[model samples]
Target chain A: MAENQKLCPMFEFAFELLGKRWTGLIIRVLLDGPKRFKEISAMIPGMSDKMLTERFKELEAAGILTRNIYPETPVRIEYELTDKGRALKPAMDKVQDWAETWLTPPDQNNGE
Target chain B: MAENQKLCPMFEFAFELLGKRWTGLIIRVLLDGPKRFKEISAMIPGMSDKMLTERFKELEAAGILTRNIYPETPVRIEYELTDKGRALKPAMDKVQDWAETWLTPPDQNNGE
Candidate 1:
């Protein structure tokens, strides 16, 4: 919105992607490496297949990640971050840092 | 969710706040300094008073910002970031930098 005119319009862009449900979590999964559609979805407990596909497509359109269609009888697709996507890691890192430092999230599953 | 058990639960916490509509914008306004309720809402074009109030309460509860009630002719209230709030700047900085470098936002109102 006004961000385009303001100092950090990119924050708006970044948020447009990350702000959606399962988007950041998808990226977080890829931070370790590339994964197929199912691999990414499995890591996030409650994400729907429809929602996961939406996030993947959005991230792909943004040039943050790419999809590879394997040349096989049954083509397989894997998603991986591009250089730009990898570059986004810093922001996520800082958010993680900020959270650990200042936040105490309520425990739900509290998986360990 | 899995964040609490895996790693970087704070990212989840940070996202829980920032991902909500108008939440990041509220924090962004406070970054400059404290502001009255009306002042913050004016900066964000279409933010409802209800939404702003909700975001303010959330951030205050998170300890990222604080509220002050000055006993003037009538009580004057302001919201300002705490040291913890200031600490969250780097994460936002990184996101802004990533956005500027890698993203091109569509312009609407284009306010400068």
Candidate 2:
């Protein structure tokens, strides 16, 4: 049906947030637990600090995650998912499953 | 754990493909059925023909979908997903479920 062909607005919105470079990896890292900026950057090797900072702002603005500042000898900053972001586990899990099933073994080199 | 913090390569590859703008939407549209370039462009409002064309090339190269050309008076062409792409239904479904649950309703205008 023609109606079925049209992309759902909500799905579009979801992808708009999720379908950015390093967003999924950032969320995936946070899904485990709160981590500081350096920690997240370290987890994802290719992602630059600037991109991580940009994604953090977007995710925070989207209500998917929150930035926490802890007062200590030196203030510590951490990024953690909100309930909404935590709920993305099932979806993220599904993506991981699909990746395992369809993606080639990581060891095998396929010329990019 | 430090080990757990590292991003999985397979997951990273999958997101690299899916995280690009309009990739998910294009795949989602094809999941319904095969359609021509014009049909796909029409279905997704605001997506220019150039974008759809680019995504089609990438998806084809990835072995996710194939382009079939029918030798007819008009030389009809259509694009369909391969098994690998079709297998993404579960992951896509999960994303849709998450969107329905967590994303704000389409009706409410939130300043972008």
Clashing pairs in 1: A111-B5
C-alpha lDDT of candidate 2 relative to the true structure: 0.80
- Candidate 1 docking class: acceptable
lDDT measured at residue B50 in model 2 versus the true structure, 0 to 100: 93
Best by TM-score: 1
Off by over 4 Å in 1: A1-10, A41-51, A106-112, B1-10, B41-51, B106-112
The sequence of per-residue lDDT tens digits that candidate 1 reaches over residues A1-108 is 365336444565576567566667778789899898888777787778988888788888889899998999788999999999999889988887887767655563
Model 1 chain B poorest ten-residue lDDT run: B1-10
| Alpha-carbon runs more than 4 Å astray in model 2 | A1-10, A37-51, A105-112, B1-13, B19-22, B37-50, B72-74, B109-112
Score residue A60 of candidate 1 by CA lDDT.
Answer: 88
